[model samples]
Target: MTVPASTAPPQDEVSPDALQAATTPQSPARRRGADTRALTQVLFGQLKELEPGTPEHSRVRAALIEANLPLVRYAAARFRSRNEPMEDVVQVGTIGLI
Candidate 1:
């Protein structure tokens, strides 16, 4: 099922650093909205470009990851905690390793 654009966060709202992940090529049509695929594209594109060694790149990457954290947290919140720790919740949300 397609997610509504309004409920999804805007791609532009995602930080530039997070958008650098290496990714599969995408056409303009794929980049048009805020669905999970679009977000995946944005994240992978950033990860691909992220310069792992430099401090600047490190900071940006951290920031982007940080920014995306809220969304992930929100997703994890959907399932019952079931005595799961908060760290586990975050780890589960971090499945977007795209």
Candidate 2:
């Protein structure tokens, strides 16, 4: 999962929210058994050349983008089961990525 940058403590200070976050119990089953390989291929296929990349290689960016999507699907699926509408779920997930 992506950590929120704003929550990270600076070199000499800490925050209550960050401390509470550390103690939070995360879900073990990330999703109802997602097909990570398939998801990665799908995400990678959907991406364009986005940029020349830091060193002109596409694989690095593709991997980075792919790595985050299964979690997106998982969060989306959970919202879906919790009564969120399908279109809304996808929109929320997209917003999460942004």
Number of the top-ranking candidate, with TM-score as the measure? 1
Per-residue lDDT tens digits for candidate 1, residues 1-98, read: 99998998866466555566545456664444345445656656776787778876666566556656767777778765468887787797786732
Q: How far is candidate 1 from the true structure (C-alpha RMSD, Å)?
A: 17.8
Per-residue lDDT over 1-98 for candidate 2, one digit per residue giving the tens place of the 0 to 100 score: 88798987767577989988878865665442355556656656545444555453466555655577667776787775566687788777867764
In order, the Cα lDDT scores of the candidates are 0.65, 0.64
Each prediction's TM-score against the native?
0.40, 0.34
**Candidate 1 wrong stretches, greater than 4 Å:** 1-50, 81-87, 94-98
